[model samples]
Target: MDWAKDGRDWPNNEHSRFVACRPHRWHVQAAGEGPVLLLLHGAGGATQSFRDLLPLLARRFTVVAPDLPGQGFTSLGTRQRCGLAPMAEDIARLCEENGWRPHHIVGHSAGGAIALQLALHWPVKSVVCLNGALGTFEGLAGWLFPVLAKLLAMNPLVPRLFARLSSTEKRVSDLLASTGSQIDPRGVGLYRRLVADRAHVEGTLLMMAQWRVEGLMSRLDRISAPVLFLTAENDRSVPPATSVLAAAKVQDGEIVELPGLGHLAHEEAPERVAEEILAFIDRIETKKPPKVSGGS
Candidate 1:
């Protein structure tokens, strides 16, 4: 995550800035001039994930996309704070300190879970999840994934080894393919650069090790903001049904499926994903009761 070495040609680099938010130095990208729209990328991803989607959304709203602590260019403050609740709390603090009140929150995968957690405390207009990882793994994977991640995260050498092993174009392509998504060469290159960085890989492992959604899922019913879950039809990472079931629990939640897409639907079809998010937010705004003023 060296800005000079790795971020010279980064997507939307013009909008990138570093802010000293306690416990971490946040790398944030902000643009446009309307209501604040917060974009959160999934695990193992960075602001680059929204390369195309950001521009589309920026045209209509002021968009802010930040690299999660310890991931991308954001330096990690505390290892334990990589979990869902702590991440949400830290992000909330980041926003408050910077005077950015997110009117709408759009999150992908693990980011979606974090968005929901934020909604429980923050008064956001709506929550849009693109293939959110809202449910626990079924059967054996339920317990094994976290345990495996914990072991890898505990070992200091695993990340370096993983980075070295996954430093090829084919390796990155295959990894993305496993999620049932296909992206252009530039996208693949960005992912390759990320996986090749030991720090980024380590951050992703720490996040996976500490992530848990049970508490957040239990409180879905409490979120006053409308929640829109966008599930990709061909997603292989988290099943489409996960969103369906999670949406059912929320006070005002709905699900939309992106046909022929995958776990990385936003990257695969940024236009389509942007359209859904814009449409959803527009509907929410239109439904709100108009402001009342007292006549003098």
Candidate 2:
């Protein structure tokens, strides 16, 4: 589905939404009814991450997954670093494009960061963060990746070199592989080929690094929307400690850690995440009991 490669059509119906949108379009997959469930995939992920769960979730809500600009089939419209402000604005645009105003949101990994930004800055009703990469990394491997990314990110020749030396398919496949073997193979293949522009890849890395310095952590308290943060007990990317810190910050928030799951909590534990999400909605919707005639 390297549409950017030969400008070929994407492989699946889900991928076609992206194809139909074409240049300057962000990839999307939509289903079900009621207030939209705006899904934001991780930096390395495409909309396909929610493929299996969408059908089930769609049974209850109108689920829509948007491949963030620079990820999947979406076009990274600028060569400059794609910061959170621009990213959040595009999310607001996607919502306006689809007429999904005042929607609910669910984001995983880097998407979680975007989701948080949306809730704080946009007209979102509520949000669910799945194994989000909000706080700083803890491990030696985590510290090392950013240090390595810094050297490579600034190299103007690096993007072209990777694009020529390696197939875009090959580079993206490497990203899918990083998530773990549990990810759907077909979905991974589609994601790997969605964006042929290596510059976009470098932009993603730059955006992540910027977050490390900009520090959105302190400002999360300003987000007034109710939040349910889902964490993975075994998540290797963002630690449970990070989610714990976030839960304490958001005024109306709770954290539920999925036991034994990894970074991709929804993929590794879809039903559990879905159930919790539905329950949260239920609680929110049940604010007032059925009307009863009363005389005082």
Candidate 3:
């Protein structure tokens, strides 16, 4: 769809901006000013996931949330780059090209994997994953979903058909509710808008088709930056134990479970999520002792 036609209606206009970089034109939104924080929404969702959370985070940091290439309003430059490794490289390149240095990176679901991928190349201070897709698919979904996505992505008419079939209010609501998340009307509305766009749907399917995380499981230990997994107790998507198991492997990895929330914890309770984020950032900063006046 042509998102430009309705750009004014998107949330957080005060801080929203677009930057053109090689392979993609990024739709980025930001607020406040201080250390840079990059917020990445899960696959299929866009910046809307952080609508309520951004204002809170912006209060303490220069929060920058962007629509990933091929998802949301961001234009996908090359379909091949939608995979995990390439997508992460493109994101880092975007930051480098735009001169935005993120000290902290926050990601939800698939975006969480992207954040971890970022730590491999960038000098980020920390990374946070909420209901992250750290584990591989299992059971019926494991065998069925990716196969369906690949078939749909390969078909030229599938995106248009899928968008037409899933664009209604009820369909969008059902999709979000299936995640065990209870979101407000505004959050639902943003999703409704996204589902109607054919390009967004196409991009989502393409990314899903190209996505890979199994390779990262073994390499998680090599990621240098500290990582935090903020899990929602009621999440049906990625089990809470995924974080527990992952934290066990890394040197500075940790997990915090938020009671009564689901996969979309940020959307359901932005205030609480922001509280945890602030505490995490504070702890990271506090660990460093003050330097002497002329030490260097």
Candidate 4:
């Protein structure tokens, strides 16, 4: 699939594995051997977003990260399938097919929203959101953004032209820079490749067009699983207040604020991000008592 290859320069090509998920061919990276921990990247990103944190996380628990539909190496399905609910359902299906009952679900940006959906729809122990997109747009943007995105995705030529026009290394770097996150060269390189690909760009456009969060936000209390919102102090894409407010609404939500980092905290400082996650997981596990022999 074109999503898996950009003229022989696939993102995280070495660890890539393909699975036939209906509607899309999934490219996943699985490692470690303990309880399941699913890592989900944001829109326009693949498994490589977790390149640094995965190995560290793998030491304590099994880690699985997959490219979302229409992004990374996953093939784009219909527009309907790209909507928030369907995207979550499809991910759940993928997990069911692979026998991965995520003991913990962690997501970045848009992926965090999906984690919430998974918690609501599946049996999950806990959820972690890294600068999650949990708020609705405001004023004219609330209406204009999705409208423009839908128009672009519907036009076959627009994505191709946009990819061609904005796929340069400088452009990719600038875009990443705008997020206030200082990504290393390697991380920026991966995004550079993604911007150059028409399929990936199209998939991103479709995702934006179908992205909806108001309904999910309205029912945040329905998410029974405990949640951890990790907010980067310098995040320019999604404000830290967004996470602070989101954490307040969930039944069991905790907020941790980190300074000197941006939206891509995992990418910028994997060690710090992984440290918090490990501690959070350990705390949750420690709270559980051991199984008693022959006890009710």
Highest lDDT: give the candidate number.
Answer: 1
Cα displacement (Å) at residue 50, model 2: 1.2
lDDT tens digits by residue: candidate 2, 1-296: 25556335343344346532322466677778887888788764666677666677788888878766666566666644356666777777767766876568888887888889888777677888887778665444266447646766677666455445545665555544444424566555555543345755555555655555145677888888888778776666678788788889888777775776667667756777788777766766776331232100
lDDT of 1 at 54: 97
Worst 10 residues of 1 by lDDT: 287-296
Deviation in angstroms for 69 in model 1?
1.0
CA lDDT of each candidate?
Answer: 0.88, 0.66, 0.82, 0.81
Tell me the deviation in Å of residue 2 in model 1: 0.6
Please give the range of 10 consecutive residues that has the lowest summed lDDT in model 3.
287-296
Model 1: how far is 202 from its true place, Å? 0.7
Q: Considering lDDT, which of the candidate structures 2 and 4 is the better prediction for this target?
A: 4
TM-score for each of the candidates: 0.93, 0.79, 0.92, 0.90
| Model 3 steric clash pairs | none
RMSD of each: 5.8, 6.5, 5.5, 5.9
Candidate 2, residue 15: CA error in Å?
Answer: 7.4
Candidate 1 residue lDDT tens string, 201-235: 88888888888899998988999899988988878
Which prediction has more favorable lDDT, 1 or 3?
1
lDDT of 4 by residue, 1-296 (tens): 36334525554456667898888888888888999999999877778788788889989888889889978778766656887888999999998999988999999999999999888877788899998988753333345446658678567787787778887888888777766789999889888778787888778778888888888888888888888888888787788888888888899888887788888899999999998887777767687532232111
